[model samples]
Target: MKTLLLLLFLLLLPIKTYSAVIEKIEIIGLKWTKEKFVRRELLFKEGDNFSKEKLKNSIRNLLNTHLFYKITPEVKEKDGKVTVVLKTKERFPIVPIPKFRAKTNRAFKTGIEIRDYNFRGMGNHIFLGLTKWFKNEHSERNFYINSMFYRIIKDRIDVGITLNFFNSYNNVFTKDNKVLGNYDLKSFKANVYMIEYLDLEKIRRLMLSFRPEINKYSNWIESTNQYYLSLGFTVDKTTDMVYYTEGSFYSFYIDFAEPNLSTVFTGSLIGTYSNSLKRGNINTLSFGGSVGTKIGYSGNGFLLDSGIPGYVSDKVKGKRFFNFKIFYRLALINKTVFIKPTIAGGDAFSNIPDNFLISPGFEVEAFWARLVDGIIRFKIFKGIGSGSDVQTSLKLGFRW
Candidate 1:
């Protein structure tokens, strides 16, 4: 009896002494991405206790990067030590976009752009593009250099900057459906922004930005130099795969400009929020609202763009606006393609419940999985109450 008891004690002791410690981590199938970049997204490192939740979170973070085509996780445990292996298949990183359009007596523009999402195996982005506009058989060229993100410290902080040179022409119109005036603008602008991620993924964060511009206007106004600063905070809890399928997002930003320099505004505030849910593969529903107010604003370029199908942004005008919107999308082709429909009602005035705008519209989206910018979209919309019009357009790229 004593000998039998001793053997049972030995087996129980081994079980009691075992601990699920991470002994090693191995990342595979990386050619352009660095191992450190993958490690940064992980919630645990070597010699740490194992957690299934953290492993799942790390996978979520990686998927949100949109840097991989497929990811498979493998785990092995022996004598309570765990070894994890993550094998990944990367997507094509280099993306190019070419645009062309020509319509008589309308504003049509063209551009060519190239972007690199991952620069030098580091998680950085850079873009170079050129745009040209045609007016009365003459072409105006625009030059720009944009850097989307550059990590400078602690992996969570980033900076972005842009330099743009342009010769632009635009027509100003009044509410009476008549042309007010036209202006030619020769301008140079510089923009810089910084972002700090509160989580491993930038789905929630804080943002600060500055834009300084110099404009040389032809006969409409004098040349001027002006700048503004914007600060915003966002809180988001969304699961991203192919696209953000469900969850909630809330954000607000305030803008401040030089006093009496450009009348862009002394200060302005905007806030918005949305919550979404997925109902099987049938559809995803999202609802949200936004409010805006401008201090010392001209209210001339007022726009109400809710991504609702039947309205153009510039047709609405106001000094302050508040609106509510509902959005829906039907999933097809494994959620790679979507049928999006939207409805919104509100006005850019004090009376929110009376005589507001109601817009309803829908669009079809298709994507090619091989290319980064392979999304194509067709949209149609109609509005009731205000800015009512029938509009349809087709576009290529991922802007929507």
Candidate 2:
């Protein structure tokens, strides 16, 4: 009786294990981007077992590339075999964009940039622009050029390279808003990075980067040349790179500056948590902070204008500093529009005032979901210090 039962169990196992296998992958829609590029983004291939989750993630990965306007995946099963069909609509490769920004009590800048998103149909990008700024009854100009190239190998290793160049004349200011000098600056920067996807869960990514930069600054007072080598590592578990509704990101880097300038170590942490409130409304809380210290003799440290609103870069210079900000965002229109209020405070430990600074600000933002996948933000800030004032800014930029 035992032998008969074993034979029956073995026979049923074959029937239960019979599942549909992917027979063919048909990609419909390729005007500029190649079929190989599209296939490389997919998570599954022919002869693999069909999974609905992988198919969904494959569509998401393709959309994340920002090259497609529309994507639809269809699975058809016939005679125990499955076929996957992907339909996509490509975006216009070349876009001529006009950029403008206005900051209260600071500068107003405008420029026209022409960007090619799908360079040679290989998911590369290149842009060139010329910008002019008007500030304090003086005019400054800058020329910018940038290029980014991305490649994926074996569905795991993600490689990218960025080249950037800038030439400009910038006004140097002291911490008390006094004009120190003006510098004619020319800089060239290049970065090479690789991201290794650890597993199919997509829960963790390891990032490694190396950047080399050279800057030449000339002024009536003196002339200086600075060279820097930066190495970075980051472990990211964030679900979204653009709109961070949840998860955390952490990064650490070390910079070595030549000519006895400064050797600095910096680290940052950012976290976001979201909850569903009443009536389909969502509330998100985000916090980010960074700390930096100089290891050697600090000649002149860079500005710490980030992590705190309402503070201009020219008014803040430090060698060792710590800054943090907390933000609360309420989705007013199903996450398409948000009312965000933030409170930020930070302190410099060296080379500046040793007092902590605080700023309270609010912003109204609209997310362009269909057209460009960007955000338009209008913000107002009030700084509470020994003697400070209110500032406002208008920003039009990409998300994340």
Candidate 3:
């Protein structure tokens, strides 16, 4: 009787195994999301292995879109087939954010930006904003609209289009720490770029960009219109969570401009590395630096840094910035409530080091998040050099 039972079990094993294979996938609560958009990020589809590990990975990929606040997946097994269902709680993708930034006794900018991270549920981003720059007496207003990240072809191609009309009152100071004057800077620009995503992970890409720009001195009668072409390559493998981030990123680019194509060339390299230990009291640490030079274009505003506090913002030829930061958990509300005493030095910007206007300051950062993954940061930073101010900035990080 034991041998007969064993024989019957062996014969049924293949039938049971086939029943475990995925036969269908169903998505729930994605009313605004296109099914293909979610499917492209999945690890398995119909007639494929439906392992728990693969389902978890698929959910992880879905989270990366930032479209949903939470995704709960269910795997159902019938007599002979497996069906997977993903129940997602979609976030309110359209958000209007108010912005404020300033240094002590310095100028400030106040604005409102409306961002749609999941435009039409296509996993694209679009934003338009207007800001007023306030100085002691002089002020200027700026407006911008951009679709800086749009996925065109599934896992293959992307595009960016942007327009900016900006007028700035840049405060110029004298060696005696007195207000020498302010430079009235006016400019308009439009950019269109395309990116070819090279791999399945979408972390590596080759980009081609075209930009037409107009730069001028409002006080002085100087203006120029230049067209530029650029090519760049990037590798970004980063994962970001509420309290921690882990990844490595690197990029390189070279540009050529038409006004002085022979001499007007520039190249840049930027990269960063971050790692976290989620098992202990300690949490995260990150460090990165960037250096770049322009072969020509030594005119005003070429470099947006003057190395002088409270001076005109754009007076440098190229860019240089670096930072070292560490994050420790203060409390646990959801995942982690706050990053207390989050300390960073060098380029004070968080996450991506895209800002190269180096103030060389140390940052005291405290931040809190919301249920839908919203973050508000209170940053108190002091400049390292002489004539530096005790700057205070309030930033709302839209986790779209």
Q: RMSDs, each prediction? A: 5.3, 5.3, 7.2
Candidate 3 at residue 95, lDDT?
75
Candidate 1 — which residues are off by over 4 angstroms? 1-19, 106-108, 135-138, 168-184, 201-203, 218-221, 259-265, 281-283, 296-309, 312-315, 350-354
lDDT of 1 by residue, 301-377 (tens): 33333343355564444556777878788876774788888777666653243446787777798875545567888
- Candidate 2 lDDT over 1-400, as tens digits, reads 9999999999878554566899999999888888988887788899998989889778767766777767878889999899999998876667677878776987888888887777888787777787777673446566666666656577676676666666666547454777777666777777777776676544456666666666667745444555545555555444432333445666666665564233443322222222322222356677777776665554554533334556655434456667777788887787578887888777655665576879898888887444333577888988787534678777665543
What overall lDDT, based on C-alpha atoms, would model 1 receive against the true structure? Answer: 0.75
Which whole-number lDDT from 0 to 100 does residue 255 have in model 3? 71
Q: After superposition, how far is residue 332 of candidate 2 from its true place, in Å?
A: 3.8
lDDT (tens digit, per residue) of candidate 3 on 1-400: 9999999999878664433789889988876678989988887889986688778667766766667667888878987679998987776777787877774889887898888777878878788999986774557788999895556755668888999998766646354777655567788999999999786556788999999999886554457778878888888676544345456667777776666333555433344444444545435445444444444454423332223222133322235445455555444454544444444444322234544333433333333322333576555545444334556555665444
Pairs with backbone N, CA or C atoms under 3 Å apart (clashes), candidate 2? none
How high is each candidate's TM-score? 0.84, 0.73, 0.72
Which candidate should be chosen as best, given TM-score against the real structure?
Answer: 1
Model 1 / residue 332 / CA error / Å: 3.7
Scored by lDDT, model 2 comes in at: 0.67
Q: Say which prediction, candidate 2 or candidate 3, comes out ahead on lDDT.
A: 2
